[model samples]
Target: MPSRVLAVYDGSGIDGDLYTRVNRWAQSAPHWLDELIKVWSAFGLGLFAVFMVLAWWRARGADSAVMARVLASPVVVVVAYGVNSVFKGAVEEIRPCAQIHGSVALETCPGTGDWSFPSNHSVIAFAAAASLWFVDRRLGWVAGLFAALMAASRVWVGVHYPHDVAAGALVGLLVAVVLTPLAGRCGPLVDRMRAGALRPLLGAGELPLVGHGHSAYRAQQY
Candidate 1:
């Protein structure tokens, strides 16, 4: 069945070409808003880094045995990105904002491929968020909502269509559900590792606790 989104794009109602709209938006890309987006994106990255530092901090003085589990959980985040990348490559669906929209908003776009299938943003964010959950369930749920907001924001901004958001949200949720649990199971072992050699690192912890009680990253994970 052809996607109704596709049908909408194919609809004859589009009054102008995407390029024309993009050109128009380019004329008014507010300096502050553009800066805001860049800042938010950067903030998210910063938060993620903070989390990793904290993760290491906690298990710093723990037993080496827990290292495997603790490390594996976060490593799963890497795998999550790989999975999302594969799916993104597989689906070349154009971004909704770029498709049949009479005018494309250039400021909202990266001037990249309109291929907005399952949102990579959604998938990757959830992956990292979910991975953290295994360490702390409350944090996990919070991260899920956080990730969801980010995904929804993409759609709200007109860069992604409703279906694009839907697909991305769905994929992200699926990844969280499947991969996160495995990471959580490593909790005890991770705790053990944190108590041993990793302890010195935590005892001597210098890096700012990004946000969470344990670490900046875990409480306010990207």
Candidate 2:
């Protein structure tokens, strides 16, 4: 069937045209490549979950400033999700697969009424990567790399359009940038958590503790 015609923001129908071409390309790709993209699209974000744990583990026994930043990562992600949700509601674009007739997406089409202007997967992945960057530049770069791939995978799997992922990535990065400084101001609270009963479980004794003034991005002991 011919791809369904949909109206774009400018009434140019670019969104429909691009979605059809991209979806066709994905359908024609190799079976292995298609499966790989599908797997990554479904499960790749778990890598970042591991990164979150590792970030906390490495920050154990570190100064309050560093610890605070690491702990605040999940919070930043939560806030980013909220921001993504707001954008989705405002834009209200349906999933590309839903808009296009006879779409052969690698994954099953998502249920109706789920707007797709900004991809939630991209939002979460980029948000986690961006927050981790503030904690450890090296590991942050690794997460950022995967985050980029995750964004692309969403389009490759035919669930989202390029613009949807782009908007999501922007929202995720913006959320991290806007929230990190505010999270930094909570150094004292982090210090208290470090000194409390959870210290051992948080891997405090695994490494020597470092102390410094509460400057959010204080030099690392490592």
Candidate 3:
């Protein structure tokens, strides 16, 4: 394992204080609620996966542009994770659970060299939420709310500092914002794929024709 970048500045100011406060609350909170957050912090990401599938299923009858974005949602999440990893490696910030003294994390502290400046869970959740926004507004809102909860849960479980989740959320949102439009541009490609052997995966329904030119094929708000 590579040497952890020693903590030149461990963000022990307000961030560490907030983490300590939350961790302290967790210690005093009801056992069931603490366990619930612990479980959610670890596994709530699965719900986002289900949301993506739901978005794809709903977009099947929409225009190719919409389908393209729905397909790209997972890709956006993967890319966001990759981007967040780069930040993690660059900062090499130690996990708060490991750095803060007298702190008790519900989740086990990650081993050394597993830097934690940006929470990977937060990145994946928010990226999925932002990508879904381009496909359907209602689904987007739901996913976005869940994303926030996921970010908070990381701190509640005492694995990440507040700044880590905030930065991760921003990275995820920005990545999706940049990539979703480019993915939307893939409508023509989706259109082509839908007509071929990929039809079963893309959708069986014929593409909806709306107006003149490409505007007819453009994705619309749902």
- Which residue pairs in candidate 3 have backbone atoms (N, alpha carbon, C) closer than 3 angstroms, thus clashing? none
Model 2 alpha-carbon drift over 4 Å, by segment: 1-12, 202-222
lDDT of 3: 0.87
For TM-score, the strongest prediction is 3
The TM-score of candidate 3 is 0.88
Candidate 3, residues 51-77, lDDT tens digits: the string is 989988887777788899998999999
Q: Which runs in model 1 stand beyond 4 Å of their true positions?
A: 1-38, 41-43, 55-70, 103-114, 184-222
Residue lDDT tens for model 1, 1-222: 643423333311332243344335534678676456545543553455455456555654433433343465556666666666666566565555565545444345644544565666666667666666655566567676777766655554446544555566566556656765555465555555445786544332223346656544622212
Compared with the true structure, what per-residue lDDT tens digits does model 2 show for residues 46-140? 99889999998888756566677888899999999998887776666778777778666789888666877789999999999988988889999
Q: How well does candidate 1 score on lDDT at residue 82?
A: 69
Query: What ranges in model 3 sit over 4 Å off?
Result: 1-9, 204-222
TM-score of every model?
Answer: 0.59, 0.83, 0.88
